[model samples]
Target: MKPIELMRAEAVNLTEDPDEVCGYWRGHLVWVKQEDADGLWYVRVNHPDGGYLYDGFWRAHRDCTAADAVAEAFRGAELLEDE
Candidate 1:
C-alpha cells in the first residue's frame, strides 16, 4: 500500500483505541502503548528484527484529540530511507 493509505489506516486504528498500534512508520514496524504518566502516550519504533529503537512522546495531550497524538508520534518516527 501507498504511504497515504498507510497513514489513514493507522490514524483510524489510533482513533479507535489510542493505545492500539499494529502499524508502521515508513517501513519500520511500530506500536502505540500507554505510559505511566497521565495522558502520556508512547510510540514504540523497532528494528525489523524486533530490536528496540526509541521512545516517542508528546505532552500536548492537554488539548489534543486521539488523531493528534498519533500524528505527534508519527512526527517523532525516524524515516529510514537513504538519501
Candidate 2:
C-alpha cells in the first residue's frame, strides 16, 4: 500500500512519549509517522513547527517545500519496506 499524503494542518505536540505522539499523527491517516525522539516528531508531510507542548491542535496545511515534501514522502515509503 502507498503512504497517504496529508496537508499539515498544524504542528502537533508529541510531548514526552514518542510512541504516543507518533500514534496521534498516524491516527490522522493522512501522513505517516517516521522518527519520534528528543521531543521532536517527524511527519511524512510538511507543515509548520506548530511549537511543542501547545494545547489544542493548531490548524495548518501541508504547504511544504517540494524538496521537503519529497524527502518526507520518501522516508515514509521506506518505512513501509521495513514493515
Residue 67 C-alpha lDDT in model 1: 57
- Give each prediction's root-mean-square deviation over alpha carbons: 4.8, 13.4
In model 1, where do residues sit more than 4 Å from their true spots? Answer: 1-5, 9-16, 34-37, 80-83
Instruction: Supply candidate 1's per-residue lDDT for 26.
Output: 48
TM-score of 2: 0.20
lDDT digits (tens) for residues 1-83 of candidate 2: 32222223332443223122221343332233323232232443332343322222222234433334323443544433446
Look at candidate 1 and tell me the lDDT of residue 4.
Answer: 33
Alpha-carbon TM-score of each model against the true structure = 0.50, 0.20
Number of the top lDDT candidate: 1
Give the whole-model CA lDDT for all candidates, comma-separated.
Answer: 0.53, 0.32
